[model samples]
Structure formats: C-alpha cells, structure tokens
Target: MRPYPSRSYQAIFWLVFGGALAYCVYGLIVGDLYFVGKSGRGAHLHGVPAWCFTAFVTFLGAGVWMREFSTISSRYRTRFEILFLVSGFSLLVLGWNYSP
Candidate 1:
C-alpha cells in the first residue's frame, strides 16, 4: 500500500471534506438544520443534535482518509473504507432528511 495519497486524490478528499465541514458550519450559524415533511411539519435538528451529526460525519471521513496511511493490513482496507464511507454518507443523508 502507498504511504500517502496521490496529489489528485488528496485534493479531491480535501475538497469534499472541506465542503462538508463548511456546510455543517453554515447550518449551525443559520440555525436552519431541519427537515420539513410534505405535511408542512418540520423537525428541528439544531444545537447539540446538529453538532453530533456534524462531528460524526467529519470524524468518519477523516478516519477513513487517514486509514489509508496506517500500518494495518491492506487486505481489509478496501472493505473497511467501503463500509465506513457507506455508513457515514448514509447517516449524513438520514440526518439531512429525517428527524431524530
């Protein structure tokens, strides 16, 4: 396994991670982190809940990226990365579209 990501891959990862972090910050600042149902009702996901969700996504992504350079066996890296990515993105989507 490579000790570090290629320049292109690093660039892409940072772009995505930065966007996610920015979006979280924006949502917190605007106090508009929520989801509205078709029935006109809304569920608020601000404050602690928003922070928790943001932290979860942020850390998950960071961990996956950092894991690429770890000393662990490469045999499971791909599987682990896939699992982390899918679960992380799923949670992010769920948080964006659903209420706790």
Candidate 2:
C-alpha cells in the first residue's frame, strides 16, 4: 500500500470532516437541515432533505477513510469505494430537483 499524505493534508482533511459532521449534527438538532428558497411563483420551497444531506456526508466520509487508511484490507476497500460513489451520486441526483 502507498504511504499516507503529509501531516498538513491529514490535518486539513480532519478539520473539514469534523466541521461538516458538526454542522450536520447541529442542523439535525435545530431542525434546520434544509435550504429555503423562493419559487418563481412566489411559493416557499425547501431544498434537499435532512436525511439525504446526512447520508451524502456519511458516505463521502467513509469513502475518504477507505481511501486514506492503509490498515483496511484492499478486498473491502474497492467495494466500499464503489458503494460510496454510487450512494453519494444517487443522493445528489435525488436532491437535485427537490422542491417540496
């Protein structure tokens, strides 16, 4: 397996990861997990749902871990990477036109 990236890179990754996780948690707690938008018809709309946002972040986070960690077996890494990509992409598409 290849070596991990520099310390600074890891630090930055963790920082962003932590921040995203914290934000997700805060949103869930506050019930403000969705974005509010005004429709052309003067109707109020909601963006992505809370569950989709949380799942996307979760899958992406796991994918990052699988890519970075040298300790995990390669056999499972590829499978998980594919799963993550598919899940994240599906979530993105599912939320692309959310307006309910």
Candidate 3:
C-alpha cells in the first residue's frame, strides 16, 4: 500500500533519530561507554551499551517502522502504534529500573 502523503511521519522519524543521536553524544560525553567487560568466566567480551545501543537501534528501527506506519492503509496503524508505545514504555521502564 502507498503511504499517505504527510510530513508527520517524517517529523516523528527525525525526532527519534535526533534524540537517539543526542543520546549517543551524551553517552560519549558522560563516560558511559561500557561496551566491553569481563564475563563470569573471566573472558573479556564486548557488550552492547544498554542505553546507547537501545537508542541507536530504536533510531534505526524507527525509520523502518515509520515507513510502514506512514502507509495509507489502516491495517497496520494500530499495531504500529501499539508496538511503538509498548517498546517506548518498556525502554523507559528498563532505563528506570537499571539506571546507573
């Protein structure tokens, strides 16, 4: 289905992208680059920085979701909205619970 010709989706997409980009910058400035650590077995491994990576992935994923979300059909609208809300809420909860 063709996407509706509206700028709202683009605005949202850019908003998310910009926020995530800002978070990455903040992470860098605030010394939150904990992307590597030792495991239980003492093996060094590179880990994903929770907040930074989450925001990064969300930024990337938002593009795809917004593309689908902007479509003219209503078939996936509710689902996308739910997904966006749930994912966003869950991220907030996770951040709150596991804040450093």
- Most lDDT-accurate candidate: 2
lDDT values of the candidates? 0.71, 0.72, 0.55
Backbone steric clashes in candidate 2, count: 0
Candidate 1 per-residue lDDT, tens place, 63-85, comes to 67747554557767767776677
Q: Write the per-residue lDDT of candidate 2 for residues 20-88, one digit (tens) a residue.
A: 878777787776664445754332223356656777887788788778854668888888888897897
Off by over 4 Å in 3: 1-16, 25-30, 33-69
C-alpha RMSD (angstroms) for model 3? 10.1
Per-residue alpha-carbon lDDT of candidate 3 for residues 5-79, written as tens digits (9 for 90 to 100): 457866887787777667666655675643334654332112234563555456446635654545534656656
* Candidate achieving the largest TM-score: 2
Model 3 Cα shift for residue 49 (angstroms): 8.7
Instruction: Specify the poorest-scoring 10-residue window by lDDT in model 2.
Output: 39-48
